[model samples]
Target: MDYAGLDYRNIRFPVDRPLTESERAARYKQESYSNASPMDFLSVIKLNSNSIDLVDRWYPIKGFNTWFGICVVLVSMGALAGIYSALFFSNRTAPIETVDWIGVSALTPLFLLLTLGGWWLIRTECGRFTHYPMRLSRKTRQVHFFRQNGTVLTVPWDSLFLTLGESKSPLSGTTYDLRAHVLDDDDETVRDSFSLGYPSPLGNAESIDKFWAFLQPYMEAEDGVEKTWHHLKENTGYLVPVDNRREGWRWSIARSFMLGAHWPYLQLLFSPFLGLNALGRMLAMSTSKIPQWPADVERESQPEVNDPYVLTWRDNGSLGWWELYWPLICTVVGVGAFVGVIAWVVSGLWR
Candidate 1:
C-alpha cells in the first residue's frame, strides 16, 4: 500500500469499475476481530466525540528497516572490496588465483541480494512526508485526506469506494492495507486513491474488517463512543509516537524499543540494533514536514467545549514517565558496560 498515496506507479485493479467482492471482498461484513483494536497500532493523532485524525500509512517499523537496508548495502560493498584487494594485491607471482576466482563467484549472489534489498528499503522510505493525517468528522459526515502538496481532499463519508490494497513481492511476500478510492463524477472512474492505517499481514481480512468496524461506529453512531473501548478509556493520552508532537529524547528512544516482545532480557539482547533504529527514525522524521490542516477543515473539526469523549496525550493515564523511558535507560547502561570492557582490554595490552 502506498501510505503516502501520492505516487501512482502501478494500477493492478481496473480503475473504471467498483472493486468486486471477489477481487478484495469490498462488501465483507464489518465486525471486530481478535487483535483488531486501535491500540495495537500507533497511527492515531486525536480522537473526540466530534472527529478523529489518523496518520496515513504510519508504520513505526519502517524507520528501523530503512537504516537496516543502508547497513546491508555498505557491508556488502566492503566485503566485496576486501576480497578483491586480498586476491589481487598480495605479494605473489600470480596477481589472482583460480581459488580466489571461485571465492568471488560464490559470494556474488549474496552481495547482489544484500545491495539490492537494502537499496529497495531505502528507496521506499527516504524522502517522504513525515505524515499525512486523515480526519473523519461525525458531525459533518465528511472524510478529509491531507495530501503532500498541502491540499485537502474532502469527500462524503459514504461516497468513498473502499477496498483492500493487496500486493505481493518475493522479498516481503504478501501485505494488505485499507484503501479508499475517490471516484470522479458519474461514480464510475476512480480518479485517485489513498490508503488508511498501517499495513497488515497477508490474508488477514478479519483485521481489515474489524478496523473498518471501529471506524463505522465513530462516524455513524448517534451516541458517543463506546465506554468499554480501550483507546477511549485505558489510553495514556501521550500523543502518538509520531513527529506530529514534540516528543522528548527519552520517549523517542523508548518508543522504538517497544516493538515485539516485552521481556526485559529480550529487550537487552536487541538494544544495540534498536538504538540505531531509533536514530534512523529521528533522522527521517527531522527531514520530513509536519502536516497542517486547512483553516476550513480545522474550523469544521473543532470539538464541543464539553466534549466528554475527547482524548489527548495530555490526559494522565496508567503509564508514567519511568515506565515509558525504561528501554532507553537499559540501552544506555548496556553501552556503558560495553565501553568499559573495551577500556579494560586496552589497559591489559598496555601493561
Candidate 2:
C-alpha cells in the first residue's frame, strides 16, 4: 500500500490542522516494522510535578528542619533546667555536689523520652503516603495528585503559569529529570515522550530542546498529536522548546519556602509563608483563567495537525511534607510542651 492510502484526514481541532491520509499510511508503514511497547495509560497522573501541591514527599527540609530543630533544642534545654530544679529543691540543704549529679540524672530520662517520641511522630507522618501521582492534563487544564487517603486532588493547571522542568531545585539543590508519554485508550504504546526544560536557573536548557528529540519520530508518525501537543504547550506558556532562564517571580521562592509547600487544597492562614503559596496559586489561576491577559504561549504556538494523544509522567519517587507530616510536627511540639511543663513545675519545687 502507498503511504497515501490510509485516508485518515477527517480529524480537526480548535487549532488549524488535521491528519491527512498520507500521514496515516506512513504511520502504518512504521508500525509494520516497529517494536512498540505496551502503553501505560495512567489511571492517575501526578498532579503537581513542578509545584509542591502535585507531588507527595516529606515536608520541604528547610521548614521542617528549622521548626523541628527548634523543638528539639527547646526540649533539651528544658530537661536540663528540670534536672537542676530537682537537685536543688529536694532539700535545699543537700550538698551542692549531690545536687548537681541528681539534677543531671533527672534530665537523662527526659532526653530519652523526648527523643523517642519525636522520632516516632516524624516517622509516622512520613510513611502513610502511598499514591502520589500528578498530571498537568493539558486537555483538562487540571492538576491531579492523589492524597494519603486515596482521594484524588484536582486543581486547575491554570493554577501554575510557570512549570518548566528543572534539573536543580534552589531549595534542595536536587536536580530533576522529567519524561512524558502518550497512552492509548489501553496504554499500548508510548506514542510520544520527552522533556521540556523550563526557563529557570536550576533548569537544563539543553534538556528542554530534548522534548522534540524524543518527539520527532512520533511527530513524523502523526500530525494531529504533534499539533495538539504543541498547541497545548504554547497556550500554557509554562512549557518551552527549552528552559527559559527567566528570574521567575520572587514570590515563587517565598511561597515554595513556606507552608512547607502545598498539600492539595489549603485553607488560608495569617502566616506569610502560607500566604506565599496562596499567592502563587492565585497567580497561576489568574494567568490561566483571565482571558484578557494572554497565555504565556499563544494558541498559535501549539496547533492541531496529526494525531492527538494524552501523555502522563511521574517524578518516579517520593518527596516532602504532607498529611503524614502533620502528625509528626504535632508530636515534636507535644514533646516540647511536655518538657516545658515539667521544667516549670520543678523550678517551683526547688524555689
Q: Which stretches in model 1 have alpha-carbon errors above 4 Å?
A: 1-18, 28-40, 80-120, 148-151, 164-174, 185-189, 199-203, 225-231, 235-238, 241-243, 246-248, 261-275, 316-326, 329-351
Best by TM-score: 1
Question: Candidate 2 has what TM-score?
Answer: 0.26
Q: Native-vs-model 2 lDDT?
A: 0.33
Q: Give all TM-scores, in the order shown.
A: 0.69, 0.26
Off by over 4 Å in 2: 1-110, 113-127, 148-151, 163-351
lDDT for every model?
0.62, 0.33
- For candidate 1, write residues 288-330 as lDDT tens digits: 5667788888898887898777766555354454445567666
Which candidate number maximizes lDDT?
A: 1
**What C-alpha root-mean-square deviation, in Å, does candidate 2 show against the real structure?**
19.9
Clashes of 1: 2
